[model samples]
Target chain A: MFKNGKCIFIAFILSLLATPIMVAAEYGDVLINNYSDEAGMRPVVFPHWFHRIRFRCKVCHADLGFKMEAGGNQINMLKIIDGEYCGACHNGEVAWAVENCDICHTGKPGQPTQVHQSTASKLTTTTKRKQAESVE
Target chain B: MKFKHSLYILPLSLSFALLAAEPSWRTLVEDGLHDPTSPAIGVLQEPASALSLLPPDTTGNQVSWIRALREGYIEPRTNILPETKIEVLDMDIIMEKTGELSLVMFPHKPHTEWLDCANCHDKIFVEKVDANPINMFAILSGEYCGQCHGAVAFPLTECNRCHSVARSSFTGKPGVQPISVSD
Candidate 1:
């Protein structure tokens, strides 16, 4: 009975810790759609987990000038091709070529991209509105 | 008539002396500390010269917060915050009415200069929105912002510095929701 209690306690602790980790993992799967869907291309489902395993958060976030918040960085195809933002690492020699659109843009049609521009804008507007309302 | 003449002469001479001793209105403008036409311009002007001031000794024992930050003595240095680009985020949190206190205009740029996101994230403060109830009492007791802010960081005594956001500006208006970037 004592052994069973210990096992249950450990399982409870593990679940408590794992619950937050499971939630955080979702943030890693960011959708890069700065100009994809807007320009008739599918939005890129950038898997943060793949990069995070090899590189530290500072590598892309700090060294490469990627904003922590999604859609915060004004990334464009021209900028990427010019070897400025994503092109800094996604060059033919470093990681992958910018020409590889299929790799990043792996979203299906007929369904709205998970990271919609309108939703993000609405969130910002809502936050601002809520703040303004509190003061009144 | 003689006494009156002396009195006038004395007052005139003193005024002349005062004008000669005082810096000219033009001189004050040249120093970038004044604008005769708009007195408020001086207050709005950036103190670019402040950076030129020599940094104090930061030996990890006793040191001023501003001096320590200026001299690059804080942790989570280049290895952590490799970005040279300074991102200034205006994080304005409107708290429940407690007393007559100005809202805090948290300038993220300055803190990011010396520390990384991890310095305060997930440890001192949870990344989740509306998790921490950070108040002055909790801060003084060494929680949330108080973890670094009063210990190695800037002291809480400097009220106006953090609470610089004018209360009148936010009065009767909703405040901006706190932005949480999950780490």
Candidate 2:
């Protein structure tokens, strides 16, 4: 005795859950999990907007040598500690020091590296938050 | 006397167990304004303290980043060092290899507005030409243009935006699609 409209709506929502799609993320936001997931840490959720706001693209892209592709850059903890990549500016003086691991390593565990897309951003609530099968 | 002591400890242990639980902070990782100061008293802020003052856009990251630039909402430095000379490459590359659809126009101007030549030259484009033969499938799979289009720039669904040049207008004949895409 459910309303016809309500029944269709429920079915539609359930069908969405049954299907796995790309995880929606904010534009420019990236989840770096090249090593974090395997190393027993949360994926590093890099908010490009935050960094780009203060610095220009070349500051990181060219100068810091970060590739355009997500997970493309082979970033590791050792390299950062060696004053490269993120460590270039993240040193004590230019920006916050790297002692607070949680500040950057904030993504859900097991999240793969990817750039947030527009299509799925709306469906973020409906997304299963599963591994990025939709990507690779 | 022992029974009275046990009675006091049971609730105490239960409350202690509950207090030891870790709180989830998932939202902090999501894309939003993580404004700590609350300086903009006018705009609405997320409970976790993100100010939504940026212009709203429907597609690509859901924020009109370019519009924000035009509005003078942000001024991103060319580099950490303010003295570094910044250059913009004013050029356009047409991909006549697009089958049936209009030719794809890759504009260096707009791209250089946010990025430098080094960002794409050797890494993404690799000397332009068909050296890195590109196709819609490759782009859709997040390889070429798909790197930014499907993710942050604009979804590939806006076909006409890139495929702007009409095939009929070309001088001789529109170039044929490449037989095999080089790696």
Candidate 3:
């Protein structure tokens, strides 16, 4: 009985170790738990790869004054709608419309559904093309 | 002995009383010492001459002194000093008593581009004047401008490079007159 209890304890430790790796793999979306005492609102998970393909480093970094440090930009919902920060480009013209609540605040736990997979893929491809043109 | 035991107890009680009284004493002292400088201990003073080195204001120019200093800049210096010739503009300014003239113009922009911000911001300049006391003596002792001017950028051995006075021209400042070089 003692041996069986030891094995169970070891298994529990192993599962704890594996959980963080699984969390990191799901990088495309982030969970914002705002209701907790530490943070006030649900944070929208931002996909880095999606934006990297669309813009140059200088555009959002140097021009937009986004800090070199990650999560350094103090963004709020009001700022986005005013087309100041992320709204400057993501305002329907470049990516998705700010008015579309479900696009960002999707009630899901992880990556939101891309509305239509066909249109999402086309957008990604066009963005990649524009990035290439700017580089050249 | 009973007397010795009582003596130890007495000193211990006194010490405890002093410890308990410390907070109120500290508050009283802080209230008495209230001043702007009291709150900002160890904050360095800005140098008076910090902005004196900059060029004079030209009409209709809205550029800040820092931006003007960065203008006409070349790439920052790295491992190897690029073999590009530069034009040195000669100008005069009164530093102190007795018209103490010197070779004021230098190829500053090229060197500035290569340097990191920290290289000069805190070390070379005090956040505020009179906060970090700097003088020619400190500079000669390997502080501020002397940190690199004589060591890495260019040797202070060249006299005319800094002190362009006619008398000290031979030993302190050397070489030909200001000549332009092409990339």
Top of the candidates by TM-score: 2
Off-target runs (Cα >4 Å) in candidate 2 are A1-23, A38-40, A118-136, B1-52, B81-85, B126-132, B168-183
Candidate 1's fnat? 0.02
RMSD of each: 26.9, 15.0, 26.1
In the range A1-136, model 3's lDDT, one tens digit per residue, is 4699899999999999886321121112223323211333223444332343234333454345554323446666677788766787768886667765434442223222221111112224656846865997
- Tens digit of lDDT per residue, candidate 1, span B66-175? 44444554333243234444343445444434357776655555565544576567766776545667788776655676554543344455566667656677654334
Report the Cα lDDT for residue A136, model 1: 75
Tens digits of per-residue lDDT for model 2 on A1-136?
7899999999999999997643434566788889986888667767765665567788887777777778888988788878888888878878776876766666667655766653344444533444444554
lDDT of 3 by residue, B1-183 (tens): 999999999999999998665322112112211122232222311111222233333211111222433452112222221332223223222122113556333333443333433344565665443344544555544566555433223333444544444444523322322442211
Per-residue lDDT over A1-136 for candidate 1, one digit per residue giving the tens place of the 0 to 100 score: 4699899999999989886311111222455566676677655555442353334444566566665545667888788888876787788976778877656655432232232222222234656846765997
lDDT of model 2, residue A98 = 80
Q: Chain B TM-score, candidate 1? A: 0.47
TM-score of chain B of each: 0.47, 0.59, 0.31
Off by over 4 Å in 3: A1-21, A26-41, A106-136, B1-183
Chain A TM-score by candidate, in order: 0.60, 0.71, 0.50
Q: What is the C-alpha lDDT profile of model 2 across B29-97, one tens digit per residue? A: 233322222222223222122214566555554456666665767777778656555788666666787
User: Which runs of model 1 end up more than 4 angstroms from their true locations?
Assistant: A1-27, A109-136, B1-183
Full-model lDDT for every candidate: 0.50, 0.65, 0.39
User: How many angstroms is residue B25 displaced in model 1 relative to the true structure, after the best TM-score fit?
Assistant: 72
Worst 10 residues of 3 chain A by lDDT: A112-121
- Global Cα lDDT for candidate 3: 0.39
